[model samples]
Target: MPFQLPDALATSDDKPALSLLRRYYGDAVTSAGAAAGAAFDGWDSTGTRTADVDRFTADDLLAITFLSVRVPPRAAAVLLRDRAAELGDLLAELGPDRDLVGEDEPLTDDCWPGWRLQTALRDIPGIDTTTATKLIARKRPRLRPIWDKVVAKVTGTHKHQWEPVRVALREQHHALHERLVHLHGAAGLSAAVTPLRVFDVIAWREGKDRGW
Candidate 1:
């Protein structure tokens, strides 16, 4: 069965979801280019640079800053220094294609290990939920969707967002993901951009418009 979007996300005759996705993504891409320059390019295009899942790179840290989040210096040091081995071991639990949309098993069952990793990251000093998720998303763009306040409030998934979002992405045999891919291509986004990211950007932009 297809997952019907909430009224907030439903498309009307005047405002189609596809067009809105394109508009929002376009604005973001433009802003990223202007603000992040090479760092954004490095982050946005997987073809140009493969992310080091086992370690956070300079580009990874710089790129997230463009998206309105920054890893505090102390936290960055902890991630890159004190807990390097621990981070690598945790990230090793996930694979490149471990996308939530393709998943059919319960998220808790299949993704608990990674969830533990996320929790550990969040436990670091100066690293909040948003910053931690963004850092993980940098490493596993397809597997981890970046969660922020605006998107969480708009989607009404503040406390337990990932499982519900996984359900939405997996609905109707991933029809929503298919639609997102279509919109991504239609919007002329980079090949590296995942369907998960397309969904996130669209929801985030819409949330911003609503002043959430």
Candidate 2:
């Protein structure tokens, strides 16, 4: 089943979940966007080690671990510290390129730079498919989509591997990106929120609400 945004939510028809999410977390999303934009800008201007790590502090990683996926803080800390350098290098490679797929090109595990990052992150002691992708997406928002059980179930890509999800995203990159941008504008989300993040939020929200 190909993923489709529900028309009710698309039009902002006061769906309970969508409305609640917007009311409760809209400000947080806006703040996150601001932080992310500043972080990226700092990285571009000065090659500081902190910038290299996507300006993520230990607190940020811990918050992401617990709030985003309910992972244990201790485990998340170990993974973050151990793979700090590798994560930095991966973000540096992705840079500002949002389009990682080529037209008429076959999508493979090694086709996009994200694949290498995902593979490496997945090998960490406490990381799994969702956590690995989320970590990278936090750093390279434009280039990667955060994945989890909800996203996989909603997208109907039963396997939690990055390859299939990446292929699907690449195929619909243009239209999907456009939709996200439109949604962002309509919702009055901060300009700093990347289209990929908007897309992830919408999918995640819909999936969670509908029990996918």
> Could you list the CA RMSD of all candidates, in the order they appear?
4.1, 5.9
Candidate achieving the largest lDDT = 1
Best by TM-score: 1
After best superposition, candidate 1 residue 153: deviation in angstroms?
A: 1.5
| Candidate 1 wrong stretches, greater than 4 Å | 1-9, 12-15, 27-51, 109-111
lDDT of 1 by residue, 1-212 (tens): 23235342455332455555556444444542222321342364334345465776666777888788888898888888898888877887665546778777666653476688888888898988888888887787787877888778667776456778888877778877777777667667776677777777767777777888
RMSD versus native structure for model 1: 4.1
lDDT of 2 by residue, 165-204 (tens): 4565555455544555666666666554576666566666
**How many Å off is the CA of 175 in candidate 2?**
2.4
Which stretches of model 2 miss by more than 4 angstroms?
1-24, 27-50, 53-59, 70-81, 97-107, 159-173
